[model samples]
Every structure is written in structure tokens, then in C-alpha cells.
Target: MGTVVDAPAVVTEKEVVAENMLGDKKVTVVFVLGGPGSGKGTQCSNIVEHFGFTHLSAGDLLRAEIKSGSENGTMIENMIKEGKIVPSEVTIKLLQQAMIKNENDKFLIDGFPRNEENRAAFENTKISPAFVLFFNCSEEEMERRLLGRNEGRVDDNIETIRKRFKVFVESSLPVIEYYDAKDKVKKIDAAKPIPEVFEDVKAIFAPYAKAT
Candidate 1:
């Protein structure tokens, strides 16, 4: 018998947007990846203010979906509660919608593509990031920040934070590695204070700042 190979899985409607929609637009995207409590949201806010880029946090969008009582809200809430990743289809849809709705063409997408599947999905959809800003922080420091944040996030509890850390190390770190191998990762030490960290972030973003 001849050898046979399976066909690739069909791309979902969300994946089609991932592959084709953003690429067709004149958009510049920077992916902000980090362990939970690594200050991704904080630095992204600074980037938005200084560089004129829109800040799109995947987590925030999902939370908003939950609050809006979307059909997927219950499933997303459950996944979040378990410290599990939401499906890429759901996340990608939210991201695409946000990008289209916003007026700015430059965006800092924070806390997304949290696993290899996510990375692959985005890549397949044709959404290549300009670069990945990796917030490198020790687990001890991250744990301290999350515990002290007092933001009342359901996932801020120590147990859930630990699970998030584990997921980052196992799932998210590989995405950084993939970008690193391509010389497309800008690694930042997130253990420092906010001002010091943004100082470093500013340097990486200087060119974009000039363009804006």
C-alpha cells in the first residue's frame, strides 16, 4: 500500500481572520508576553501613551466578553477559573474585532498567543508581529507582585497565580523561544520598578516613537 498522510485541519473562520484580515491592513502589531504579574499591562499602557499605539489586552477582552454575557461567556469564565487557556478561535475573534474597531493602526497586544497553538494559529492566519516584547521576571518576584496587587482579580489568588506561572513556563515560554530564534524578541527585565522597566522598554520602542 502507498503511504498516506492526513490533510491539515481546516482553518476556522477566526483562523481565516488571523491569516488574512490583519495582513491586508496596514497595521503594526507588537506582542507583549510575560508571566502573570510581570507588568505587561503597566508597560503596555506606557507604550500606548508615549508611542500612540492602541493597547489590546487579551485577558481584558475576555473578561469584557464574560461581563457582556455572550454565549461563550460561561465557557470562557470556566476556563479562566481553572487557569486554562481559552480557545484560540474565541480569543482571535476578540482581537480581530478590537483591531478593526480601533482607529489606530499600531497596537500592543498583551498576554496573548499563550501557547504553541496560539502562535501557530496567528502565524497561519498571517498575523506576523513586528516583534515580541518579553517581560522576563523571576517567579518569586512575579508571585510577590501578584499577591500584593490587590486588584480583586479572580486569578490573583496564590493558588491560581501558581498555576498561571506554571502555564507560562510550559506553554508561553516556547512562543518567546520561537521568536527569539528568529531574532524578533526584545527581552525586558520586569523585576525592576515601573519607571526603570519603562526606561528599558522606551529604548526598544524608540524607533516607533520617532515614527509616531
Candidate 2:
């Protein structure tokens, strides 16, 4: 198992207390939202590697279910291919169970709360992130990257790609707006190269990057 790092002093002083007051809990969750190929996954990896936070990727969880050959595996795989979100209860349950099993205070939850209903469910569960990281990339660039991803997944097709973009515009926009209104959203330009993108992400997380 990897070693856990010490919580940053800034986080301890600023967010920890307030977050504790909100739930009287120790966990610190940073929710990240972005459209397909917006670099959310890459940034999450960097955050976990540098900051020692647990990374909970919703997309990965869904993919795992699809790979499990369970009763819903086929259906889940089809949904993912079409860029449609899985049901909230299913995903929220998965997230809760994962968090319970891990027992980590710091978490970077990637690719979650895709729609308003999904966001509300998380909020209803009394789970709130210290802040949200939103990746803002142009539509053209996003399409370009998604096409290039060529992950041989069902969702890699052009029809589904366009559908995903449309769904993202319609369903995910309000969630971002909500976070923006609360003044807890950090927008990152995800159109740049991976290293440059990570540099910006690193700066956002520098306060928490010290090795414990």
C-alpha cells in the first residue's frame, strides 16, 4: 500500500474546518467535471501521483462493471458507448461503497455528477466537495481529441461522440453553473498539451502537493 501524505496546512486551516462543520467529517473531496476528452482523467492522475489523494473515477467504475460480465454488463457497456450516463443511484452507490472501503480523507472524484439530478443526489447524501475543478475546452478541440483517443470503445464512434457533446452541453452545463455561482469552481483550459495542462493543474494543487 502507498503511504498517505499529511494534509496541507492551508487546507487544514481553510477548508478542513469548514468542511468539518458542514458534516463533522474528516474526508476532503475535490470534485472534477469536464466534457469528454477535457483532460479530467489526466489531471486526476497527476493529482493523485503528486498529492497522494485517492482518485475515484466514475467512468472507470462503470467500465469495471461492464467488464465484470455481470447481469448488467452488456447494458452498461452499451450506455457508455453512447455517452449516456448511468443511473444516479447506481453510480452514487458505487462511489459511496468505494469511499467506505478506501477510508481515505483526500479524494479526487473524476467524471461524476454529469447532470443536475446526479449533483442533487450527491448533495442529498450530505457529501460536498471542498471545491470543484471545471475544465473549459472548446468544442472543436474536444471533438478532435475524442476522435484521436481511439480507445476502441463503443463510445469512440462519431455518432455517439456528437451525442455525448450534446448531452454534455445540455445536462452538465447547469452543474457547472451551480458551482460557479457558489464561487467554488476553478476553470482550467484543457486545450493545451498534456504537460502544459498538468502544469496549470499542478499550480491549482500546489498547496497540497508537499510529500508527507
Candidate 3:
């Protein structure tokens, strides 16, 4: 007879809090925003290496929830499959968990706040970003890059990509506009090569760079 195995227990938000993951430490956040394939991820990697900030991709966190077999896993998976944004509460919880788990207080949060609801939820937490790093890229260029990315992401198909682009235009842009009105956005021309893009990113992040 084969032995039965139990699934790993899902981590609850309450449990996360019990662990003091969301301690009383002050947090510094930088929102990284762009169209899909705008090289936000690539440049964030550079900033983390040079500036000592942790990179936390919202998409990655949600995907991890799906992998963890949590109760919300199925819902998150469906949303991502349809290129729809997950609920703000779910996303916020994941981001909080990541922040609490990491030792660094500074974070580069990528691919989040897909709409006003997300923005409000995050604001409710009373943790505002230091600045928003906006990566500007043309749709034609972004489409080309997503097609060639070959990262085996389920949402990488042309159909899902188109849906994602539509959502970004309709839902995500306003969040950027809101920060822009506050003069908290640092726009970058991301159409350039990866290295060149990082150069511009480096300049914006220079103030936060850690000395050797």
C-alpha cells in the first residue's frame, strides 16, 4: 500500500503577523511600473545589486501563492490566466509577507497596483513608496520583446499579452498619473538596450546607493 502524504500547510496572514514579519521597522519602497516587457525586471536587478534594495515582483509573489497550494491559489491562477489583476487584499498580503520576511527595509516592488483599488489598499497600510520608477516603452516594442522572451510564463501567449496590455493601459496608467501629480515619478526611456536603461536607472537610484 502506498503511504498518503499531506500537503504543506499554507501560511496565513495571521500567522505571518504572529511571526512579527511585519515588525515596527520603517520601510522604504520604490514602485517599478511599465508595460509588459519594458525591462522593469532587468533594471530592478541592477538596482538591487548596486543600491542594496530588495526586489519583490508582485506577479512573482502571487505565482508563489499558486505554487504553495494555498486556498487562494486557484483564484490567483485563474486571474493570471485571463490576464486579470488579482484582488488588492491578496496581493497586499503577499507583498507584506515578502517585506516582513526580508531583512532589508528598502524594497523595489515591481508589477503591482494594477488599478485604483490596489493603490488605496496599499495606502491604507500607510506605507507609501519613496518614488515611482516609470519605464516608458512603446507597445510595438513591448510586444516584440514579450514574444521573444521565451520564459515559459503561462501569460506570455499573444492572447494573454494583448489582454495584459489592455489592462495596463486602462487600469495601471492612472496609478502612474497619480504619483506623477505628486511629483514622485522618475520616468525612464526603456526603449534603449538593457545596459543603457540601467545607466538611467542607476542615476535615479544614486541617492539610495549604499557605500562600500
Candidate 4:
């Protein structure tokens, strides 16, 4: 943690270009992170409805990229299958593209920058998150939710879910800690019922509310 990690020069140049492009639009990105079944998608939808913000799920975007058969699609697909984190460069590029394509200035980007590589590479983008919304829930509860969600997703099985949870604790927690160190994380107790949890979320996002 003490030593600095540098991204490749090419990554930096590309990210800087993206930074300059998004910078002109004055983008506001809020990173939404949590375990697989942590209700991040549900809450992000609520935020978008109540606030004038776009919701972009990193996983969804990657999936879409795969479906579209983009050049990086195969790599992303393989990584996802093995539960490996995709290169931060690819995810960041997708995020930048989404941000640029949307008309909304503020966006809630769900499920990204889940490791130190991501955290470090993101520095070059210069499109810093307004804050990170961290959802905290018990593994037991998350596991139950994942089993019952019936999404028919490949990773919804108990084996994958357990592995994902372990990976989250090992990798994602550090990203949360980094943001916490910077005082840029809003922790939400997601173990509660959906509406009740949103009530708390609404309070944190009150300032960003849009006129109804």
C-alpha cells in the first residue's frame, strides 16, 4: 500500500485523452460497489428515477460488449467465466464511452474498480467519482438473496456466489478502504428491506435530487 503503482504509458495517454474529452462535459460519476446480491442495481434504479442521473452497470455494459462481439469481447468473456477481473483499461474505456454518449452529467456506475489495478489506473482518467456508494450486507443474507433472485445467470449458483463473495472481501474491500481514507465513501446498510434501505440512501443523495 505504501508504494506507488504506475500504469503503462499507453494506458496513461489513452486515459488522459478520455479525461480531456469527459472533462469538457464536467461529468459526475458515482461508483456503486458491493457484493453480487447487495441490491446495487435496485438502488441505482431508484437513484436514477429520483435524480437526473444515468445508471450504467459495468457488468451489463461488459455483457453488452460481449454480445456485440467487439474485439475485446472474447477476452472479457473469458475473464468473467474464470472470475478474473478484466483489465482496468478496457472497463475504463467502456465507462468513458458510456459517460460521453449519455446526455446526463451525473452517472451512477455500478460494479467497477474492484481492485488495486483498477484503483491505480483510474487515476489517469481524471474523472474522479463524486463518491463511492458502498453497500454492506451479511454474506448469509446475500447468499439467500442470490439464490432466490432467479436471474438464471451463470454465476448465480451457490459455488460461484460463494467464490464471488470471497473475491469481494479480498479485492473490493481495499477499494472501499481507499475511498474511506479519502472520505469519499457513503456506506449503506443493505441488509434491511428494500424501501427502508432506500430511505437511508435517499438522505445521502438528498442534495443530488432532481425536481419532480
Candidate 5:
């Protein structure tokens, strides 16, 4: 029997816009990735204000979906409780819906593509990120921040937080590496103070600054 060698799946980026439903409008995607307490939320807000980019956080969207008692709620809830990544289909659907309903052209998509499957699934959407904003922080610092957050999130406990960290390191870092190899990652040091951290993020986003 002849051996069948399937080539690895290559991710090709669509730089301008997403075709389906999004029409011909230019859609700029910046993937925001970090650990649980890496302060992705705060910095995303800053980028939105300064860059005119709409922020669509994947985690927040799923949480909202769960709260709405949708069909996926129980499943998502169980997976979250176990610190597992929700199915890419569920998350991707939410992202696409949000993008279609929004008025802005540029977007900062936070806390998504948690694994290679996620990265690959989003590629099918034909809307590739211009760059990946990576918030680099130590596990120690992240643990401290999550413990002090007091946000009442179910995944905020010490045990669940640790599991989330494991998932991030084992799964998410590879996604960052894939972008890095293509020179599409903008790495940021997140251990600094919020203002100082924004200084770095601001520089990266200066090219996208809104005219105000």
C-alpha cells in the first residue's frame, strides 16, 4: 500500500477583511493573549479608547452566554469549572456574531484561540489578526493578581486558577510562537505598573491611533 503523507495545515492570513457576512469592510484583528491575571482586560480598554478599536473579549462573551442560560451554558460551565478550554465552535460563533454586529473596523479580540484548534478554526473565518499582543508575566505575579481581583468569577479560586495557568502554558504559548515565527507578535512586559504597561502597549498601537 502507498503511504499517504498529509501535509501540515498552514494558516494563511486575510489582511483586509472577512468575507462572509462581514462583507467587504476592512476588519483589523489584534489577538490579545495572556494568563488569567495578566491584566488583558485593563489594557484592552486602554487600546479601545486610544485606537478606536472595539474590544471583544472571548471569555466575557462566553460568560455572558452562560448567564443567558443558552444551550451551551451547562457544557461551558462544566468545562470552565474544570479549567478546560471550551469548544472552538462555541467561542468562534460568538466572535463572528459580535464582529458582524459591530460598527467598528478594527478590533482587539482578547482571550481567544486558546489552542491550536482555536487558531485553526478562526483561520476558516478568513479574518486574520494583524498582530498578536502577548502579555508576558510570571505565574507568581499572575496568581497574586487573580487572588486579589475579587471579581466573583467561578474560575478565580486558587485551584481553578492554577489549572487555567497550566492550560495556558501547555496550549496558548504555541499559538504565540506560531505568530512569532511569522513576525506577527508584539510582546509586552506586563509586570510593570498599569500606566507603565500602557506606555508599551501605546507605542505598539501608535500606528492605529484615532484622530479624535
Candidate 6:
């Protein structure tokens, strides 16, 4: 846990690209990786407000697909209820669409690149994050949070939550290791209070926080 770093109201793509080169902006795109109840959603919101970045949640994208009554809606709903990763192509299409539609350069991508395939697909297509913010918490804490979340969604049930947590551990660990090897992974102790966890997150991005 650390203090929040106030940032500029807007960050441009050029600035994002310039950061790594200039050694000033610590991160360009920040991939927020964590389990279903690991506070990735909550932290992304705070980061967006304080740091002025676009927050894209992959779950929200799939939920939108289900809501849109698209051709794949039924299948997506089933897959999500089963706590399974959606097809990379479909998921990447949604992510790409969101990225293209957004004008913000600094992005907080939540719940994406769930597995090695998803990570590879993104690497082959989209601009990679300058760094990744990983919210690390124990499985017990995640289960407690998800059960208490009370979202009433099918995916919030205990069975699905447990499945999703297992999927995350098995599939997402490699992505974390990959970023860790590159010295681009910022570890946040997510077991702490939400504000406290975000404090660490804000500090990690402080160097890149544009001064107003």
C-alpha cells in the first residue's frame, strides 16, 4: 500500500510512447491482471479518474456481446457461465474495437489476455502495455470477495467463481511471468483495503502521471 499520485487530466498516445524512451513515464498501457474478485475492476476506475486513462474490462465486453443479442450471444453466455475463456479471436475483436474507438492513449485493460494464446494474440496485434499492474491476492480472499460481491450474476455464484479462479491461476500465471521477466510487472498487494491497494498502484504509475 502507498499514497495516491495525482496525475494530469489527459495523456496522449505520443506521450505514452515517449515514456519508456524518456525514462519518465513508467508505463504506457497498463494491463490490470487479477482474479475475478481481485479488485481489478475497482482499481481500474480509480486509475482512470486520477490518471486519466481508458479503462477496458474484458468481462464487460463479453457481457455486452451477450446483451447485444449478437449471433454469438448465447454461446458467449454459456461459456462465461461455465467460467471458460472466450475464443481469442472473438475476444481480441472486441478489444480491438474498443481500442480503435477510444482516443485515450494510456489504457487499463482488465481481465484480458487470459491465457498464453490470448497474450500472444494481443502481442501479435495490438500495442503492448509498457507495464502490467498485477493485483496479487490469495485464493481464499478472492473467494470471499466474490461471494460477498452479491452481484446476482450467474458468474458470481460460488461454483463459477471457484472455476474462474482456477482458470486464472492455471492460465494467467505465464502472462505475469512474461512481464516479470521484462521488468514491466508492478505487483500490488490486493489483499489490503481497496484504497490502500490503489495507493500502491498510483505510486507505481506516478512517474508517468502527467503534470497538469
Best by TM-score: 4
Clashing pairs in 3: none
For residue 50, model 2's alpha carbon misses the true position, in angstroms, by: 0.5
How do the predictions measure up, each by TM-score? 0.81, 0.78, 0.81, 0.84, 0.81, 0.76
- Cα deviation at 135, candidate 5, in Å, is 0.4
Error of 4 at 201 (Å): 0.9
What lDDT does the true structure give each of the candidates? 0.86, 0.81, 0.86, 0.88, 0.87, 0.79
Q: Write the per-residue lDDT of candidate 3 for residues 1-212, one digit (tens) a residue.
A: 22332222344444534432247677888898999999888888888889999999887888789999877898898888999757898889889988988889899999877788899988877677888999999998999999998788988888998998998999999999999999999999999999888889888888988977
TM-score: which is higher, 4 or 6? 4
Local error of candidate 5 at 200, Å? 0.4
Tens-digit lDDT string for candidate 4 (1-212)? 32334546668787766763484687878889999899998998899988878998877888899998877898899988999868889988988888888888998988888887888988777778889999999999999999998767987999999999999999999999999999999999999999999999999999998877
Decide which is better by TM-score, 2 or 3: 3
Question: Of the pair 3 and 6, which is ahead by lDDT?
Answer: 3
Error of 2 at 22 (Å): 12
Find the number of clashing residue pairs for candidate 1.
Answer: 3
User: Once model 6 is optimally superposed onto the true structure by TM-score, how far is the C-alpha of residue 120 displaced, in angstroms?
Assistant: 0.8
| 82-131 per-residue lDDT for model 5 (tens digits) | 99768898899888888878988898899888889999999877777889
- By lDDT, highest first, what's the ranking? 4, 5, 1, 3, 2, 6
Q: What are the RMSD figures for all models against the true structure? A: 5.8, 9.5, 12.5, 6.2, 5.3, 10.7
Residue 173 CA error for candidate 5 (Å)? Answer: 0.5
Please give the range of 10 consecutive residues that has the lowest summed lDDT in model 6: 1-10
Candidate 2 lands at a TM-score of 0.78
- 109-204: candidate 2 lDDT, tens digit per residue: 887788899999888666688889999999889889888875888887788888988989999889989988999898999989989988888888
| Two-way lDDT contest, 3 vs 5, winner | 5
* lDDT of candidate 1 over 131-200, digit per residue (tens): 9999999999999998998778887888998998998999999999999999999999999999999999
The deviation in Å at residue 210 for candidate 2 is 3.3
Model 2 spans with C-alpha error above 4 angstroms: 1-25, 65-86
For candidate 1, the C-alpha RMSD (Å) to the true structure equals 5.8
